[model samples]
Each structure stands twice: as C-alpha cells, then as structure tokens.
Target: MRRADRLFQIVQYLRGGRLVTAHMLAERLEVSDRTIYRDIADLQSTGVPIDGEAGVGYILREGFDLPPLMFTRDEIVALVAGARMVRAYGGPAMARAAEEALVKISAVLPDTERARIDRTEIHMPLWVVSEEERRTIDTLERAVEARHVLKIDYRDEAGASSCRDIRPLGLWFWGKVWTVVGWCELRGDFRAFRIDRIASITCDGRVFKHERGKQLADFYRQMERDEAARDWAHRRSQNAP
Candidate 1:
C-alpha cells in the first residue's frame, strides 16, 4: 500500500470515535508499529487532529466530519455482488481480506440500509479451486513479491516435460486459469507458464537483481510484440490459402 493511502486508512480506523493503538493500526495495515508511529506523526504534522501518545490509543477529535459516503441501494448491491465474486473467484487469502473490508463497510451502515447488500440475489456456482492450483497461485505470488527465482517442472499441451528456472515477475488469474509471467533463464526471454501445467515449483532461494529488460513494463512490450506477430502471421496464412 502507498504511504498516503495507509495514512488515510489510519484516519478511517480512528474515525470510529474509539481509541485505536499504534500496534492495532500496524496490525491492520500490515506495517510495523514504528512505521505507524511515523505515519501518525506525519498526519499530526499536517494538522489531522489525531489525539494520543505512541503507547496510548488515539482517537479522532470531535466535529471533524468527513463528507458522508452517500451510496444508493443500487451501488450497495454492486459492492455486495463484487465482494461475493471476489470471495468465490479470488484466492483464499484475497477472499478473506475482501470479506474483512466488507465487514468494515457494514459496520457503519444501518440494518435496513445494509439489507440490500445482504440480499443481492447473485448466486455463485458450486466451484472451488483445487489444493494444488491454490498452492501454486500462493507460491507464485510470494515469489513475485520476493523476486525469487523458481525452479519448475512443467508439461506442455503435447505432454512434453521440461524444467525451467524462472525469475518470477507477475501472476494473472483469467477466471479459469492462472498464468505466471516471468523471465525464463532457459529461454533467455519472457514466458507465461500456466499454473496448472506446472508439475512442481520450488523457490530456488535466489533473488534476482532488478534488470531493465526483465521488468513488468518489458513484459508488456513483449506481449504487444507477440500479438502483432500473431496478427501478421494470420494475415499471411489467409493470403496463402
């Protein structure tokens, strides 16, 4: 999370008109208490009207009204439906995190006003992510965050097996499949390996330097090049036939 956003979130937590400790803020934001202390100091420096010491809990001063977040019934329904979709499709960790946010949103709403969210009428199909796939997604996410090199055993559509060392860069979920994009040491270029095709993956405990051509921006460029090449090839094949 960006520092500015984290600082705003701390204000929201304090707006409950209750004493919130720096440790509690740190836990909620997934940052160190020292970092929270620094953020609080930064907010106070800007005259945010937060009250308390580092050890004691802090509360927002009275009469500091944030413009109310006025949401209609339709908007609340959308938020509820979106949260349900995230819970159903996003990974387990993300699902729980999204639910926590929904709970926070519900906390301030009245019972009648919150009923639209409760009865959204949107139904999710009975589908679940398998253990293997879930683990692969989680592992790839961690690898990307840590910039760890991963050793993976992968099988292609033709059932040919190959081992690769990939500098984990990004992971994308496309409803049904998870794709892990990375710089392949063996290929000497960028590659997108399907999570399901990966028989095994292990973090090699080797962190990679931030190389220019291996960044996410470079990967996007490679994707554009691949799309253009496919279009040219398809046009040529049509002309030939």
Candidate 2:
C-alpha cells in the first residue's frame, strides 16, 4: 500500500478517541512498528492532534476533522472535462470510476464550485469508441497492472497478422485510439499494438519482472530520444538552404 494511504488508515484507526497501539497499526497496515511510530511522529508534527507515544498508544483527539478538499477554478474545469472524456472513451470499469470521481468531487465542492462543474462546456461523444475496443482496453490495462505476459493476435494497419507474447508495460491513449505498449518476446524489442487491431488477447499466466532496458521508464526515455532526433533533423533540413 502507498504511504499516504497507510497514513490515512492509521488516522482512521485512531479515530473516535480510540487508543490504537503502534503494533496494532503495524499489523493492520502490514508495515513495521517503526514505520507506524514514524508515521505517528510525522502526523503529530503536522498538527494532527495525535496524542501518545510509541509504546503506550495513540489517540486522535476528539473534534479533530479532516479539512474539505479545495480546488481552484482552472483545476475544477480540467478535472470535470477530463472525467467527462474518460467516462465517454474509457473502458466500462474506468468509466464507472471516472463517474464516481466526478460525483465525489461535486459532493465535496462548495455550491459555486459544483455549479462550475455543471457549466464546464467540454463533452465527448460516447459512441466514438466501440464496446469491443473498450473491453480490449480494460483487459490490457489489467494485464499491465498485473505485469502479466499476454498472448495477442494482432493485425497491423497493412493487414499483416502475427501472434506475440509480450510483457505488458503500459497503455497509451492517442486521442481516438488506445495502444498497448510492451516488450514483445517475439520481436525481442518493444512494440505497441493498437487496441482496435488486436484480434485476441489473453494472459499467459506468467508475471514479468522489471528487466534493464525493458521497463516503462526505458520506453519513455527511448521516445524522448526519438523525438529529439526528429527535431534535430527538422532543424537541419530547414537550415540546408
């Protein structure tokens, strides 16, 4: 679990004037007692109203409540517009989660901010992406998260078909299409397959480990280098005259 999430859980466990022990918090959060102690100290330093020490126990003082979320006007507009786009173009589970996020944002915002969300003019046509492609996207997303090796039958733009076993690294959305970028076992290199061009994809029940020069960071670095090379070539061509 993320440290932020663990800290939040620690706070929740100490609520209602309950004296929660460091050991108890550690066990519940699957972390060390030292981590809980550090977290408690950090929370105390941040004026979280946590009372008590490492050995004894800790309690969140009564009347202490988390502050409401605050967002600037531009932040609200961007969030609402992005959520609407995801709801329209993302997978079924993704769409539902985006909808819930929008609802939660609206529920927490002040009345004026909530009104701004409704007034945000950005919208997306729901029919732009087919249901089949959405399902494919969902599958690939799960595979990427799980670090699973996927066996995919893909047809390229020129109608060439090939089956590949790939270590799913990440998904990239290019406005209208979704592409799964992975380290292709067949090609012995990184390859990106469009979701629409994927005829079939299934997990091979094999999880992959991060290897040197094959991870997502490596892919991004490669992309940056390629882009820089293209820019240099463009500049060279323009200066030729």
Candidate 3:
C-alpha cells in the first residue's frame, strides 16, 4: 500500500465512528505501529480531523467529508495496469472510457505522479482478441452490472445449439478467452457461457430476483465441490489400478 492510499484508508477505517487502535490500523495496512503513529501525526498536521491517544485508538471527527483521491506510486501503477487490462479485454467503448479516465487522472495529479505513470513499464499485449470479442465482453459486462437477463443463442463444442434466458451474475477473463457465469433458467442451474460461443444475445427484459442458490457465492461453492469430487475420483482410480 502506498502512503497516500494508507492515509485514505485510515480515514475510511476511522469513518465508521469507532475507536480503532494503532495496532489494528497497522495490521490492516500491513505496516508497523511506528509507521501508523507517524502517519496519524502527519494527517493531523494536514488539518484532518483525526483525534486519538497512542494506546487507546483513533476516530475521525463526525461531519468531516473525505478529500479528493490521492494515490501513492504503487497504487497508481495498479490503477494504470488495471485500466490497461480493461482496454485490452473490455472492448472499444470500455477502452475509450478507460483511456479518458486515465487522462483525467493524469490531469489531476502532480507532474511527479504523471511522470511516474508515463515511466511505468507494465504492459499487456492485445494480440488475437478481435473487436467483435471485445464487444461481446462489453455487452455482457453491461448486462451483469444492470442485472439484466440475457437471451442468448448458444452453441457448444459438438455444434449443438440452444437458446436460454440467462440471469447474468459475473464475467471472468481466462487469459485468451472470456466467460460469463450466470443462472440459466432453462437448465435450472448455474452455467458458465463462453462469450465466444454465444451466437447472439438480446435483452430478456425480465428482472428476476437472485434466489438463494443462484448468486456468485453459491456458484463458487459449487465449483469447489466439483473440484473436490474430481480429486477424490482421481485418488480412488489410482488405488483401484
């Protein structure tokens, strides 16, 4: 964590109106108690309404609004890398928005920070992902964010085709490919749809509520169980042979 980001997190941690101890803050930020002490003093000197004793804890004064965003060098690097990845995989509209946002971030930052951003060497190559694939990712991202049900014409590896109304939950990138995980109304189960395999997609316009077993956490739990079962089967097969 950068000093600037650490300071911002301190404010956020303190904002919940509790006396958070130095040890707690240091532990959360993966820094030393001495560092937290110094950071607190620096923040107070800058007129931030942070009040506390050394051993007891610190709390932010009520009615104090957070100042503008600040980033340390490492945080800026992370931000830029993330934005670049979005540009690499998130398609044209998203790429344009990310670029514009980076421009705005650069404008607000000091020359030192801007220079750091310019000098940063992190890069992701966009080699084989086409404009159409990126557009599909963009469309799926919009659907997930908006909680829109998607009606998709899909094809599997055997060239079997199916149409399904999918309650979009999340989108994931697997290096060379992109996947959208969702609740498939037809199968009555969660399914992972490769965006590349989706023949066509349209809005279903039905805003169905996410039931208890149909959320992302549920999907993760199911995946874990499947992996565990596969491992168990492999071990049993070895013992049998």
Best by TM-score: 2
Q: Which segments of model 1 are wrong by more than 4 Å?
A: 8-38, 41-48, 52-68, 72-75, 110-112, 126-128, 233-241
Clashing pairs counted in every model: 0, 0, 0
Best-to-worst lDDT order: 2, 3, 1
Residue-wise C-alpha lDDT for candidate 1, range 6-57, written one tens digit per residue: 9879988998689999999999999999999999999889888989998988
In model 2, the runs with Cα more than 4 Å from the true position are 13-34, 51-58, 224-241
By TM-score: ranked, best first: 2, 1, 3
Query: What C-alpha lDDT values do all the predictions have?
Result: 0.84, 0.89, 0.88
Using all chains and alpha carbons, the TM-scores for the candidates as numbered come to 0.75, 0.80, 0.68
Q: lDDT tens string, model 2, 143-176?
A: 8888889899999999999999999898889989
* Residue lDDT tens for model 3, 169-209: 99888988888999999999999998889999999576767
